[model samples]
Target: MSVDEIIEYLRTLPKGTVVRVLVMDKASGHLWSSIVENVVDGDVWCREDVGTLIEDKDKKPTPENIDRVLAAVPGGLSAFGDWLTQEGWDILRDIYDDAIDALR
Candidate 1:
């Protein structure tokens, strides 16, 4: 999806839901990583870092990184449900779905 769509989806989240994007860095002959974080912040917060993927000067996670975390995070479906219940965060489930598709 487009950035605006992603941002909009993020905006609709209830509150205080820990949302993050992760990316890989192929620097120093090894692969490192960083995270682009966006908590509810009463709405949404977005910061896309460049050079994080190709270098480390200004690091930020990539969409692929987010996909990896999502794959590893146990109870992926329940995580959102839990967010809704525990943090009262409104999750835009479709956003995640679209994210996965975009990465694929």
Candidate 2:
């Protein structure tokens, strides 16, 4: 699906609906899952446990801080969809299915 389609679909969801995405660390080749907590103004706000392992005096991971923003535009959504594993795609499909069922 196109990014616009994905964004429009996401907008149909209620606030606080959670979506999961996998984040990869380039330096360590490690991967972790992050949660998309909310969608606002065409951006998906996320929180991840990425920066927790490092000891940084200047910065820290907190709930108030957003880990990343996934743009609702075509490029952004396309990249996100491309990054997903088959299982991740299945999860997203399930969410879409559930939304459709709820609307019926």
lDDT of 1: 0.51
Give the winner by lDDT: 2
Taking all chains together, the TM-score of candidate 1 against the true structure is 0.26
Error of 2 at 104 (Å): 46
For candidate 2, write residues 53-92 as lDDT tens digits. 2225346554333233223335675665465556565877
TM-score (all chains, Cα) for each model: 0.26, 0.23
Candidate 2, position 1, lDDT: 62
Q: Lowest-lDDT window of 10 residues in candidate 1?
A: 42-51
Q: Model 2's lDDT to the true fold? A: 0.52
